[model samples]
Target: MQSEDNLLKVLIAEPSAIIRNGLSVTLKRIPGSWIQPVEISSIENLEHVLETNKPDVLIINPNFWGYVDMTTVRAWSAASKLKIIALVSSLSSDVILKKYDESISIYDSPEDIKEKIFRLFDTSDTEKDKSSEESETLSSREKEIVVLVVKGLTNKEIAQKLFLSTHTIITHRRNIARKLEIHSTAGLTVYAIVNKLVGLDEIKDNFTL
Candidate 1:
């Protein structure tokens, strides 16, 4: 177990409950228990949270910057180590994204979010080792499943295409989730594109599915 002093405090400032809750759920699934995430729906409450919570990381919407002065926030918390990450829900310009230490899209997978958070803090050896090990375990069949999944095929459809039982397909999906630490299809889609298993043009319309 990690000590309290070593805990990674994460403050999520998002207006949408759905997005805020989604990010909170994904962050909790990361390899370690040291992450303590707090959510707030309003940017107005951000300064108070920063003063009281003193979070190590802040995941916020880029639009919030228009309302709050980031420079003032940084000055107020200058004594502590604070990293700001943009929680992007829509297309943001390079100039806007450059203001953040890192940016995560709503479509990004749990694994991708984990990597970004880990990168920010220079995570421990145990977390890094586990991620490295999981990355190497996906079989060729799993890759095929991921491609079909990104292409917007249902489990039953994939089963029919692969000449396998739906039960077997479900089992394979469970194993894939365990191996990749990615439970959402959006994450799988991102993984497929990143690994070149599928082309963006092939799944552009169904990427959110």
Candidate 2:
């Protein structure tokens, strides 16, 4: 956890120009506290944000997941220890809320977001706090396979998309089952939601998924 005296640099990866600016203004309510909001419109700018403007926290909308690859996000979070705050209108996955570094509902006013941010100052030190949603076991390929499987892809479709043999997909599926102890598509979908691998919309629109 960061000390209360240190400035909390928040990077807003929200898509709407309006919300980004609004969050910038809203997150700076504390008197004498230096809470800076560095705004970016898309995931493409994440590398620049990390290299040039390393933020202490990443505040993003649920829609951000739609545009960004979840595998990259998970890897970065594990390696960077960058606190991820997913601000959503509604939360379907308690695991995501429980496992993610932080999850705040949009219905909660800006004051609520501010309160959560302040509370997070005590969340971790050298390591990020763990939640039921987190796992250090899966390789990046396994994560990809999980996402495709949750999207209701057949083993053949997943193989085609990933450019692997169908047999390879089958092996990976077995490995996933062995590692997570989950065999059903519904169970895997819940795992993905808890792990923040995919959003509800992705499941609803499998073609785009």
Candidate 3:
């Protein structure tokens, strides 16, 4: 159960007014939960709201019909001190999977919204156990990649940060998938969070994700 004092403040950054409104209503219905949903049509508006509100979590639509860059998301993550939950229509492609990093959580279906929300806000041993399993399965390179990925880096960004080619980064990502037996970025994001390879506080400095 959520504590009375610690309300789960949330920001919904979606371009579609209908989706935003529907999600907001659902979030508000979660018993003992407090949510603040903001509809943002542009990346600039999203940034502005985050700066002003300092939300605890951000639920974003990656296909918000705008030119969103890695820096934009990273900056939002860094400034708002909020965990990002990315909403996508599907979790099947490599390009979207590549966007999976520690700082962000990915949800494929609208049905998954509440589950993901509760997981983020709830502090439980069940979540801890799940995280432990994920940590135990990671290789050294994949672990390194997780840290960088959480920092909102693209494949090229991660490769450049690690002083390797983009191709090498892709190879590492492939190996990560093979070792974990997971194919989607959403899976990787969950793994990262559960294991603490990517953390909420780690983004305080200019360190890797």
Candidate 4:
């Protein structure tokens, strides 16, 4: 467990003062969490802060930045590998809140945001340990296979995507299972979800009977 004195360095990038203040206050109330809301007029400034701070996570609203320049957000997500949790208005239709090709985790209320922060920060240490062990056990090819499996891709689909024979994909799948001690796709999906190798929406969007 993280000590109360050791807080996560969080960067908040939102245009709305009310929402940003609310989130900052809520995070401060958490025992071992430090959230700094960046006071900026635009997304460009948010990227500057990220470049400087390299925070553990970023919380921002996509609408605040215009659609075309959203590439800046995607660049930050890829370059910094930041765990981005975006806020979206529930009133908006067709708002999927895709966080740079990854699924955006939604928070409908302050309570929901609080729950997510606790969940993300509380499990960080344990997950890091498990991730190290898991990484060591799988070969490069096996890791790729595991990622695809967690993405809920069938052997045939994975084969097509990877431009390999279905038989080869099947073999890789079996070897991955044996190496990871995961016996079924269901198990792999659960592992992926827990590990954030793939999001729930990505799995559901790709997986088909």
Q: Which candidate is the best by lDDT?
A: 1
Report the lDDT tens digits of candidate 4 across residue range 172-195.
565456446789778877776786
What TM-score does structure 1 among the candidates reach? 0.57
lDDT of 4 at 32: 44
TM-scores for the candidates: 0.57, 0.50, 0.49, 0.45
Per-model C-alpha lDDT, please? 0.76, 0.68, 0.61, 0.58
Candidate closer to the true structure by lDDT (higher is better), 3 or 4: 3
* Tens digits of per-residue lDDT for model 1, 1-209: 67889888899988888989988988887775568899977666787788887888988888764645557767655336688888877645656666666677675557667767767666455686764454335656678888998898999999999988777677667657755779999999899889888899999989654
Q: Which candidate number would show the highest TM-score if scored against the true structure? A: 1
Model 3 TM: 0.49
What are the per-model C-alpha RMSD values against the true structure? Answer: 10.6, 14.6, 14.8, 14.0
lDDT pick, better of 2 and 3: 2
- Candidate 3 per-residue lDDT, tens place, 1-209, comes to 55645776677777777777777777777655565566666777777777776777776766666535545665765443456666543233446534532222231123335545655545445576674344335445668887776566799999888788777677667656755777765566667777788775654353334
**Candidate 2 lowest-lDDT run of ten:** 127-136
Tens-digit lDDT track for model 2 on 1-209?
Answer: 44755777788887778767877777776555578788888676865675566578887775674745444665555236577777654333444443445665443455546656665665346434442223325656778999999888899999999888787677667656755889888888888988899988789654332
Q: 1 or 2: which has the higher TM-score?
A: 1
Could you give the candidate ranking by lDDT, starting with the highest? Answer: 1, 2, 3, 4
Stretches of candidate 4 off by over 4 Å are 1-5, 31-39, 68-71, 77-79, 90-95, 100-110, 121-209
Cα error of candidate 4 at position 27, Å: 1.9
